[model samples]
Target: MGEKDKAYVEIYDTTLRDGTQAEDVNLSVEDKIQVALKLDELGIDYIEGGWPGSNPKDVQFFREIRNYHLGWAKIAAFGSTHMAKYRAEEDPNLRALIEAQTPVITIFGKTWDVHVRDALRITLERNLELIRDSLAYLRPHAERLFYDAEHFFDGFKANSDYALATLKKAIEGGADCLVLCDTNGGTLPQEIAEIIKEVRSRLGKDISLGIHAHNDSDTAVANSLMAVSVGARHVQGTINGFGERCGNANLCSIIPGLVLKMGFKCKAGEPERLRRLTEVSRFVFEIANLPHNKYLPYVGRSAFAHKGGVHVSAVSRNPETYEHIRPELVGNSQRILISDLAGKSNVLYKARQFGISLSAEDPVVKEIVVRLKERENEGYQYEAAEASFELLMRRIVEGRKETFGFFDLISFRVLDVKRLEDERSLVEATVRLKVRGEEEHTAAVGNGPVNALDNAVRKALLAFYPELADMELEDYKVRVLAGEPGTAAKVRVLIQSKDGEDRWGTVGVSHDIIEASWQALVDAIIYKLLKSRRKRLEAA
Candidate 1:
């Protein structure tokens, strides 16, 4: 499409407000401020901070945000239309919106007749007045006023005339944009497209339209995209599809879709910035304390992961054969999962990923392949434990191996004792280490054997490397190998460790659970120390 014919869609992020509605998703005022800054950095057009009338946290959020400078995003304060019992000027919600002092104010009002009568217990005419008065009152205070027609799709389906009447009232009240909301999230893409087409025809070509969709039907992203395809110029979504019920539309997926697939320009439309979609998506997930959904589209870990032999072989020859879009387009890399179904090409590709100089014809490559298969058979999954696999590959490839010795471990002992008199069990660990030919012995007690072991090791090494204090174990997971002796199954342990700047995962497998955990813990500490040493050397 030519520049003259190009469509520009404004991307509005509601992660702090709508996203917090998702179960188990909560953000502090500081968190809200951080996310708003990140959205601004990502070139988002608008950020709906929160509803100031709903809670004191949101009110404080508005106050806190006044201190920061948002380069591109206009912060929006969200609320509902005036209550039926109060005048727009007297409404607490409207007063709170004004207090927020944002450039944009968005207020959602009931458009469905059922919601108007059943929820609000007000006449249809009264609801229309509420919509009009609320926007009219805020019109002078805000640079842009948006009226979200709540339950719009269902309202239009049930009573098209009433829904259109509500929109007309909002327009007459001087709303800058009319947002059509799939509040129930049950509308399909085809239905949304047709309804939007009808709305555009009735509302006229000059009227700006926005879409707000939920994911209860698992089509929120699809519905939003469909609305844009039809004529909606503004798209409202939360980061990672977070909201009440299923979620709102996912901006991570929608941004790339609108820009790359639909030829629309959004703030995130620039190719270079758009490539950071994965980083941004993961950052939001991290802030939410939610695990990243590996199966998510565009920015997921497994989006470009190939597991099957034929798929890996073909992707190796030409990524275009199995991949739809280039992985680099979204700042994600192609991952070749090693499994029983993997071929020699998978091993070769993996070797290259580690920067190990090995050829398809090299005997060591075959050796590595056999080693992977044999270890996998014994319950080692390199795909989920890439750190262990990388160390293994380094160990197998002679002369290319890196040294793992930062400190030498002399011995360790763990003691677990339960006393009837105490009514509580006790665990203690002692670790002996040698650094620069000097030996240090340290002992510590902890809630569990692993904790004691971690304490003892760190206690012994803290003098030699004080920065180790910054590194702590974040997560520890244990999975027993399936089809093995149930009670005697060999357990695989994965430990994730993080310093202030970076996180790394290490793995170990053994029949003894404690031993496996110890191996992983040791590897975690080693990885951290090695990384720190490298940074120091680079600085020097």
Candidate 2:
């Protein structure tokens, strides 16, 4: 069907504004611009750039984004209603919104009497004036003017008359759309449906309505969908639910829900654009330097992963037996996890993924399954550390044991010294390894024993393998196993490493923290070297 023929819903992404409000999510101006372009490519209707009045970085973002032309997405500048003390034209916040020069300007105002009295410390009638005047003053400057009735749901519940009055004020000021915000994210789906129905009734069906929901109650996506089910045409959310406290509604889940299940079409819901969902989700996470939530619906890695022997057997036969939607629909792929619960079918699946030609009847496949179970029993989780699992399989396949042909660890020592006069400890490490029958020795100093060891090992190997210079340790995580033992408990280290092109994870477990780190680090280095070797051979 043509896009014009479908029932359309507008997708307003607040990722740049609301998503950055997430703890530990800080995007530079360049990052924001890049993310804006990505959202444009994904076909979002509006991209809330940021609150230009709030900070210099956001203001700078507004100035910088002007240079780039978006495909179809409109840039939006967000701010609250003008302060009660000042006229709309005199208010610096409103002036900043005008200065932003965005085609769309979204201004939020107090919707509840309690906020007017308690938060704004103004008379309810005066708060209405602020809402009306703010939008009226800016209405002419904005191609599309939107009024976000902040805390609209809570306001409606507290005093239905006051909340409806706020909408009326926004309409008086010429708001193109009245966005009902579940600011606290406490409303349920049924409540959303009922409230929106009441709103449509009072405001008349001709008014344009939008839903901006938060996920504090973990129902943002549900509430958004319900609002749509009841006639809201605009949805406001962040990708992957990134927002303050809990999160905003996740556009990642909401878009697919509207397109596939709810039969509503959006620019992002087009089949071709929908396929970029996973990539955009990961890109935002990457730009923020946050780990991806693999459990996120539709766009997460584990979303379509089948692990259990029975489940894998069933999914291999018919994906619909387990999956709700095809993983490819959101640009995610089916992952077969290798664990103690894995059977030969899991092994065969993984073997094919790794480009290994192993038949179901191969004795080696059973050997790999048994060996994987044994390793997992020792606190080695291959699911997050696929490089280690691949190495294990390759070792077994090549009839070798323990280590690969790239290099072997001979011995390593770390010394940490602290003096009363010195504020911090100094750590040094010496590493000796055998590479292609020759022994290489190196020593290095670092902030910690693990870092010192990493430096020393790389220092020793760099002379022989210059490609190792391109590899960097992206993240390192340590999990204490058997915590009852406390200080003496075994620890599992998962090391994430990346070179110029790809990233891989490796794992190791040991009673000693440094030893576990070393094991994972070694696996990471070996994986990189092996990948480089494979690429070189393929080119030849």
Candidate 3:
């Protein structure tokens, strides 16, 4: 599309400000600054840093951010309108906005008549003056001024004339753009489009427009897109939909929809960096110490995973038959899961992923498929435990290349002890193993049986392989198999391990939790050793 023909929309990211309101999300000053740099690199138009007066951490963020140079995104400080009793210039919140020294200023004001009367305990006319004076006071301090009309859609529904009046005052006060906010997030897409159209008509075509939506109804992304369709030029959202309750619109989904689907132009929506959306999404979650939702649209683990027999076959033949867009476009790849419902294509795809040279016609492909189906039937899930699947494929394709004879397990034992005088109990474990031609023995006590076993096993190997000290189990999960023995059912164990620079997963299944944990633990150590050996060889 030509530059003139392409629809241009401003991409404003509120992940740092609004996203922190999520129940478990809290970013330190350093974390917020680091995220801002990443967003700047991704070409986001505006980065809403935080409410400076709300907390000391936000104040420090603005101070620290001034020391660095952002390439593309202009930093915006977010706050509300002036207080009811104070002048715009005298209000601490407005003064903090100036103190932040950001090029962009975003302030929200009451657009709903109910908020004016009930929340502020002020008359409707006074609320209009607050919106006007707040924007006018900050307009000279910022290169760009944005006004968020809080509850614009809901207010328009209840009192259309009053909502229109607030937008006019903001325009009269010199707001560069007026953003309609669906704060309650209850408005439908059709309602949003119509309201924005009425706004455009009443406000005239010369005024700039934007949309800010929440995801309570699971339609924030859709509502933002619908508003854009009706001549709204700017879109506001948080990464991964992080926000107060449900969330704000997800910029990860909204940006792609605008640029790739709607033929719009966003600097951050450039095709190359846009492909990094998945990486950017996960990075935010990591900084916030939050678990990523693997089911999110376009960037999730399950977004492109193909599982069923017919679906895998069709996806292999033509991905478009079942897939929406190419997974590579958003930094995700096609994943063919190995399960009871899998077929030859799943096995072949997995082999290719591990760099194993195999073809559909290879008889070993059929063998691998059968073996995977059998293991899956025995309550092994290789989807989340990809390291185990890779090991299984390598053993079948390369004939036990991973078994490097690092060490051989002899036996292990666990003991649980309790004292009648105290309420606490203790567990201890001992492990015996052989390295080359000698036997080594070690024992350790821990809070639980599994913890003691981990310590004991690592104790035995740390002498010969000091690198083993760097490897620790990051997570462990177990699931009980149905249709097995009722209370004494078979269980599957998934172990996630991490070294200094890398993480991997391994799995095991058995009726005994201890045995199952041992199996997975052994596989994890073996994989780490094999990886270390491969890296040395490649360097040589």
Candidate 4:
């Protein structure tokens, strides 16, 4: 068998299509094409573009990016079987698939009995006919056509005979490849392996088999690997596991697992760019305007982080004791967090990470670390405020004072109004604040109450801290802490602020968005203050 056929299976990235379908993850056509080109550069085998005829944006994407060349990935256009009882050649949707002018096309068909009768409102025979017609029509018009057996595993469980019959339809219909999709996202790893084994045996190695799993049960990664172990050659997922509901399987985990653990090769003579895995993962999240998952496998911020004394010691002695693979292999790094559970080594490592070298005999640094942990137990999170902790350590250990503190907002209020002159009403804010124990009251107009409050509060502070003049609010997110309605919801606000080269995160929880925004705003200013202090120290 050729290397692509034997050593490791191919990776098909569907992050563009299925991942963008997730709630609140709408990327423009420019974003889609840019990300797709990057994936091709990364040597991904296939990149599934969106359904062309479904929406105007998708249609625009197909039109705008039709001529761009994808060197590595075979761009696959996604759609469903033309409506039931309709001939594929006559269906407008299938025709749109051809009009897109992509080399590959993928269409899903009902494999589960429930979808056959309930979702499609069609007979089993007609459902089979739909799968057959869709694949056959695209087969002649397109170079490659893949048939997705939606909910195939579950459908097989509900009615194994019927599911097998559907697979036969795709086979007879000239599908270049068949993917078993866990569309409902409920199948387990063992089940995936068992059923894939059965399918491969029944299909008799006549065609390529694929696995497309969703992470409803958090087992999507495991199930994908299990399927690969059984015989599936192609694996489908959204990058960073972005998808509807739970999510599709995370390609971040799958790619490294295949290359490093399962010994799959991307291509011979190509430098192993698998090390760029984490970088690409973060880039995709940035393009999608989503926060990177700090706990995600391989690429997450805490992927190889260790804090326990014994574990850190063991890892420092030999990384293999704690890390499954060296973090550098995936473009990640080793992190040591400082907490109450930390030992002497943890403090030393953390200090060094901040460019401070200390010996074990530095009793003052040790005492300061313990005191900081004590305050952390009281709800002061220094992890997001490393620069703050460093300054505090310097003040305690080195007695370096002569510093500056920014203004504090004492209280603020947001009032809503509806003026007859404007259809889009605005919110007004009032604030009474203090700077270094001096009093100042300010009011500002803004699009919303929270915006008005933020402007007012910052206006009060920008005087003392001129850097605040240069800062911009990158992102603001609100989360409800309790399941309640009508002025009862406790809310949390997370704010990201960027000033020149420095970006900081601050979080606040309160019963009011204004109050929460105030806390977050204050934290942001303080983070900037500490950051400025650290820079001064480094320069000195």
Number of backbone collisions per candidate? 0, 0, 0, 0
Clash pairs detected, candidate 4? none
Every model's TM-score = 0.69, 0.68, 0.67, 0.64
Report the number of the highest-lDDT candidate: 2
Clash tally for model 1: 0
Candidate 1 per-residue lDDT, tens place, 1-540, comes to 665147889999999999999999988786677678778878899999999999999999999999877788899999999988899999999999999999999999998999998999999999999999999999999999999999999999999999999999999899999999999999999999999999989889789999999999999999999999888999999988999999999999999898878888987878867876876787676556455698999888789889899999999889999888887787676778874333356566567776778887888877787787787667665443456667778778854323365678788899999979757789999998887679999999998889999999999888888989999886666777656678788987777677788556677789988888888888788767767876899999
**Residue 323 alpha-carbon offset, candidate 2, angstroms:** 7.5
CA lDDT of every candidate: 0.85, 0.88, 0.86, 0.76
Alpha-carbon deviation at 179 in model 3, angstroms:
0.6
**lDDT (10s digit) by residue, model 2, range 1-540:** 344237799999999999888898888886788689889989999999999899999899999999888999999999999988899999999999999999999999999888899888999999999999999999999999999999999999999999999999999999999999999999999999999999999889889999999999999999999998888899999999999999999999999999988888999989878987987897677556566788999988789888899989898788899999987777776766863333566577667878888997889988998887688668786655778888889889987646567778889999999986757898999998898899998999997988899999989889889999989987776777755577988888877788778677788899999999988998898889888889999999
Worst 10 residues of 1 by lDDT: 339-348
Error of 4 at 153 (Å): 0.5
For candidate 2, report its TM-score: 0.68
Pairs of residues clashing in candidate 1: none
lDDT of 3 at 525: 88
Candidate 2, overall lDDT? Answer: 0.88
Candidate 2, poorest ten consecutive residues by summed lDDT: 338-347
Off by over 4 Å in 1: 2-5, 339-540
TM-score of 4: 0.64
User: Lowest lDDT 10-mer window, candidate 4?
Assistant: 377-386
How many Å off is the CA of 356 in candidate 2? 6.7
